[model samples]
Target chain A: MSIITENNDIEDIKIEGEYDGIIELDQWFDPKAENSVLLILNQRIKLDHSAFEALWNSYTIKICADGAANRLFDYYRDSDGKRYHPDVIAGDMDSIREDVLEYYEAIETTTVIKQNTQYSTDFTKSVNVATLLLLGIDLNAVEINEYDGIHKLYQQADKSQLKDIPLLILNGIDGRFDHTIHSMVQFYALRRQDPYFKMCFLTMSDMIILIPSSKKGYWLKLDKVKPLIGNCGLLPLAGPNIITKTKGLKWDVEDWPTSIESGNVSSSNRFVGENCLIACEESIVMSVELKWDKITQHLIDESE
Target chain B: MSIITENNDIEDIKIEGEYDGIIELDQWFDPKAENSVLLILNQRIKLDHSAFEALWNSYTIKICADGAANRLFDYYRDSDGKRYHPDVIAGDMDSIREDVLEYYEAIETTTVIKQNTQYSTDFTKSVNVATLLLLGIDLNAVEINEYDGIHKLYQQADKSQLKDIPLLILNGIDGRFDHTIHSMVQFYALRRQDPYFKMCFLTMSDMIILIPSSKKGYWLKLDKVKPLIGNCGLLPLAGPNIITKTKGLKWDVEDWPTSIESGNVSSSNRFVGENCLIACEESIVMSVELKWDKITQHLIDESE
Candidate 1:
């Protein structure tokens, strides 16, 4: 079962043995693809004006997590000196400035979703909005609740047509460590609940993919990303995993017994080739250090 | 099972019912008590000079993880302008600068344990050194191995006498998101294996306590911390936990279910009072955002 979205531009990776599922990690969040729904969960996005501008323009739909709307207002501006606003602003209206809200409200294209509920985080609310919008469910058409809009929205939506929608989240994994860990846990839980949403957390330091457990473990295509990342890691997020096999890692392990219970994990593992396969009994998170310089250069070249 | 040291300064928190265990969060790393092993994990320790001095002077022993030695070398210089040197430096030695290593090495008191092994992280190796040292077993006395010294040291030392040792870690939770999560996971696993090391991860933003799975749950005395923190979170780090009960949170939950598998969690909870009681079926990590301004003010007052 391939989770990859019919993307096979690269040649099929030659594995000695068979695999269960295919996860095209690098290709899914490619900047050029411009397919991901961008969510700014923070004002701490370290991207320069050009990079932020490029990133903002690449995504089809952009959403801000409450106060992040203020960050977007401050971080980037058009050549005409006007601020770039997100398509939708969703949160519990506690942190965002009123002036900023009015600024976006004035724009007819921007929708301000004031969901004042502690049951879900601003991030979750934003994701819900993105999922609904991506599914072509008009906010005006949906019977939305002030709290837990997804519950109401899920009931009315066509569940069968739900395909994997890529989400490029910024500053989602920073701020508090527990918040960062919580973000990971949320992805795991949310992914299980709605398999249609695929998360790719991007920070200045690194990028993370929460690889859910599969009976047939994942074959990762790293061809496009081999040069962009530094040291990578295959970590157990929710539970322990019995790693049966791996390929193309700097220090490849076979039949490796991994347990969060025992503190045994594969961290700081480098990507030595263009392809890799992970055969594990349970879910594990994979991370690769971003060569920000390289990414910035690529973005610069793209603009040229 | 009271995990707190014998030092009980305030009144014993009275719960209406019964409890199985006690975890004193606020008092464990009490600066006045000044009994801890301070470890610099990165240069990102945001403590100002007086604050750093106060923190450094509080701990009995200090250790740095590899490149962090350089961070220490650069971060704190005495009134004499002499660089601050840790008692021990431990890691794979890949990131540490040669000059910084030599500077620490020249100090007759500083011992650099260059374990070329990747089996355990530098942070783990530093913990091993701290544990062995805290247990009064000298590095010279222990039958040490270049690779996996903890295995050899554990064999030589009497494990029964290993009481709970408080560790004050800085820059331990920042930098990469995975490293932050990995650090938390390590504490969970390490604490389970060796219940003696009480972890207090103090970064600029927050402090995290990895509460292990207790048969009776935990009673967190948040008395002293009520004024020093902004918002707190009861996050599921390793796996899911059925949160049966909680007290002292602004929005308390009863018979609440928590699952990393499903993303159900208690985040951004406020400290309503001075004490908290959490009843959970599985392991859970709790965090409180530090009021850095207040802390800095307190440090200034203390210095005065």
Candidate 2:
């Protein structure tokens, strides 16, 4: 018996096998698709080299948000004695070290764009760059002197060409609580404006995906390559209480009423089956534990 | 001009002169009050020695949640050459190293309780133990052999004797995202059942507090000893959209309507004044960045 949605509409949103394309990066590589962009933020956490390399190889564009350039430089400097340059280096240029800035600027292939906008964050700037680049907007045509270059580029870009691109945001979580919350806010904001853009937040520990409540519901099929490591959670972080029904969980809920106030938020819940079906009354954040062993194995394979 | 809440009646919730007491631990010590408890969880982040020592000195009760005993033992093994034993070591015997467990057990002052309950988390078990211990319940009367010993003790404790003790939960964040969210759920659960209990989550970087909306509102005063390091944020994590009015921030909002869906959540905002006043239409999570310099200075003072 396969997992079914709350409304029993299993035929409509039944995500069978791995080809559903529901914004998950469990597979090692997507050679056919090259639209995904990996955005790196300036949080000082020991990023998994294997995970970084996997996303790097999978995605078409790699952009570093400010000081993340320094991190990338340092990461590769010690590991392989090779300078790993991002496709585009964009941010307010505050936290990026002077030497690191020079090193990246000296790289002929890297486009080091200094966006000194106080209104938006470095991560936002990187997202704007990703959108503009994905939309096939000419970098020289867009006015780069303005405070909101990305916003300007976004507004002028051909909307028809702006397809929903998967953005793998890295090092955004597990930082200071404020920054982590800010990233979450951005995640929700981007999803609300453009449902086409699939933004998946990747940390060392887990992968966070925003599961929107729709008439069709959603099916999350677990890939054999990326099995759930420890536990997963369905958090009702945003507005209103979340009434959810799930299948393929160790402790599956029929119609669990969850809210921050009611004290019934589901956390530390394990995935029991290969696939999970979620039917939510309201949009909620669902995160799956990332298996580090599989991720590191990929890294080893890449190095060999 | 001092910051005021949304309501014109500022007299009721005016937090003045750093003594308003809104569950902040900026000061090195609360010499007057010794009722607070420091609950250590098994998340393996490096605990700031100064911050840990400060909290240890401030609170009368120190309890380790399972594998946190291992952390405490490791932290003090090389330094001070003393086996700093917690008053109570509670939680399921899962992650606690065998050597570390034996070390704590050998200590005469520490009461090591093995709570092998699958229903409740280790942190929750520790909380139950804290509630029972703080209520002056006799430990001998409680059935230690049972899985739900703390829960049973909590049931039998005198209601009048129970006090709203501040619990400083350490290393709870930056681990598994599910565990972190679970800890946050517990934070709300404790607050809902008992308004008097003030649960403060402390990390290496920040202090998190939940401010509930009321006719009285809330006032959070900045302390000279505990100055804001980088930035502060007002986050609406759960329930309804938060309509907030604040002061003493770099970008003070008159009336900010923030929701997860709206994408207007305030994060990476700075504190501008000594005191900040908040009037919220709904409960919100507020966090302030901690100064590592001052914290390490406190540690230095202790060592000298």
Candidate 3:
């Protein structure tokens, strides 16, 4: 099965929609996928059990960045929740409450790793931790004191066996501006390191994914991802691009030249078809609105 | 006083910490500057009155993007509010409640503009509207049925008399991933069209500003920006760049290269000095933590 469909129309570079490279965003929750991982950042735990169950049901290796463990602690305490312990809690030990740390540490299955190095953020550290854990490394065997300790481990591992995997990040995209952009930068950076690993930064309403410049032709399966509210955008975060041809958008662009300085951007465009087609000369950031009512409709949707 | 300081060290184009080009972020609230304007987006109104008052004290023209009028309406109803009426309510007329629209329209100064055009976001339209009003054009004087209506008016006006102005945007930075990124794009776009205008996207906790590439050497007076919790970040949102040299960050990099694809980024860095010096080869986004205790300690701190 081919993963790309090439085209030459729409005043720039156009491609026909194909099912080969279908970005099935909803498939991240598959329990059978061993490559899938879940990482949480510090945003208040606001979703219902079903909201979490949808994410938790994925049954992936779970990790939290510092104080996110506190949020998880509170959510379990405040609601009639299925207490899901994270595989690892990692960060500078700044925001995580003492009581919460003790609670998660008491669990034999959960490991607490504190890296106080300020060179990278707790987020970058947590992401590094998740990537290594997914690579089948025993973090408990290593003494991780540096911010990039886990990162160094990943560098020495055999990447030859890895397949393209999904790292679903929760409550990570909508907080501080720098945190949000950094998340995107890491996506680009991580992909550069190992093309088999990609991240999906999620909030209750949307998910952010990158269509790497190396892969010019793309098909985004957003109907199941967003349903009726298919509000989407193709952000030129990596650099300027002369031809960004897209299909199935409410305001589809023919040959939009986008630059941060020139101000040619496509934000707030809605997905109008079952799938959207995108082709660009450079890497672009894509975000789509998410609807979980259907996902959790029958699967224990907790009313918050 | 020259706005740029030149330096030849740091393994890249370096700059001295000059008093010029000092971006005093605190001055947006001055009632004396006619160019300073306030714009509200569709985030829930959660700040204390002092929070709004700090922004309102800047006392520039106030306008809300579509449904933000509803949030302003609800905040007034739910809190110990002064009920500062917005001068204009503008957008696609979808999210704004009928009652809220009528409420603001009843006031003599407030105008309700319905521009259902999808080419631009309501934030973009509201910004266009703000820029026009700042340029001394009465919005009420024009028939604006299209998204770029206000933009057209500005293109026809005299630009020689205007000075570089500040547009303080509230509840905009942290939203949908695209919304957050789009706000930054407009800043770059607006600056491209008129070098005399700039925007500051403010949250209760932080503010985002662009250090334009055109000006290579710049000094950011961030002592007042972030007091004790000096959490800050310089994002490479516009494109790839080399040598984003800085002097005031806790882990300042020397001649660092930043790109979305390269994963080389500066996030979760903090200020350790009174002022931060920056010299970038291309446009980079900067965000800093905000401390309002000093601004609101005595100025009516309405706790939410």
How would you encode candidate 2's per-residue C-alpha lDDT over B1-304 as one tens digit per residue? 2232332312232355432235344432342344767888886647666656665776788899889998888776545578667889888888899999888888888988888878778887888888777777656555676577777766666656555567778888888777777777776788765555677787877878777674344566555543436677888877555454665566667556777667777777766555567767777887778777675665446534
Tens digit of per-residue lDDT, candidate 1, span B1-304: 1121222333334555677776666443454433468888965556877777766766788999989988888777768978776888888888899989888888988888888786677887888778777777677555667777765676566767666667778887767755776687767767766677787888877888876565555777765556778778887656656776676666667667776666766676666656777877777778888888777666555545
Clashes (N, CA, C under 3 Å) per candidate: 0, 0, 2
Which 10-residue window of candidate 3 chain B scores lowest in summed lDDT? B1-10
Judged by DockQ, which candidate is best?
A: 2
Q: Against the true structure, what is model 2's DockQ?
A: 0.69
**Could you estimate the TM-score for every candidate?**
0.87, 0.88, 0.85
Candidate 2 clash pair list: none
In lDDT terms, which candidate is top?
Answer: 1
A210-304: candidate 3 lDDT, tens digit per residue: 77653345777653344435567888888887545566666777556877667777776776666667777776778877665665563343222
User: Given candidate 2, what's the lDDT at residue B125?
Assistant: 83
True contacts kept of each: 0.53, 0.82, 0.88
Q: Across residues B200-300, which tens digit of lDDT does each residue of candidate 3 receive?
A: 88776677888866334677754333442446887887787864467666666656787777777677677666666777777678887656566455333
What tens-digit string does per-residue lDDT give for candidate 1 at A205-304? 8888866665556777765566777877777766667776676676667667765556766776676667777777777778878888777765555556
What does TM-score give for chain A of every model?
0.88, 0.85, 0.83
| Ranking according to TM-score, highest score first | 2, 1, 3
For model 3, the docking class works out as medium
For lDDT, candidate 1 versus 2, the one ahead is 1
Clashing pairs in 3: B29-B58, B164-B196
lDDT of 2 by residue, A1-304 (tens): 3232323312233455433235344532342255878888887546666656655776788899999998887775544566777889998888899999888788877888887778777887888788777877667555687567677776666666555577777788888898887777776778765555677777778878887775445666565433435678888877555445675566667566787666677787766655677777777887778777776665556445
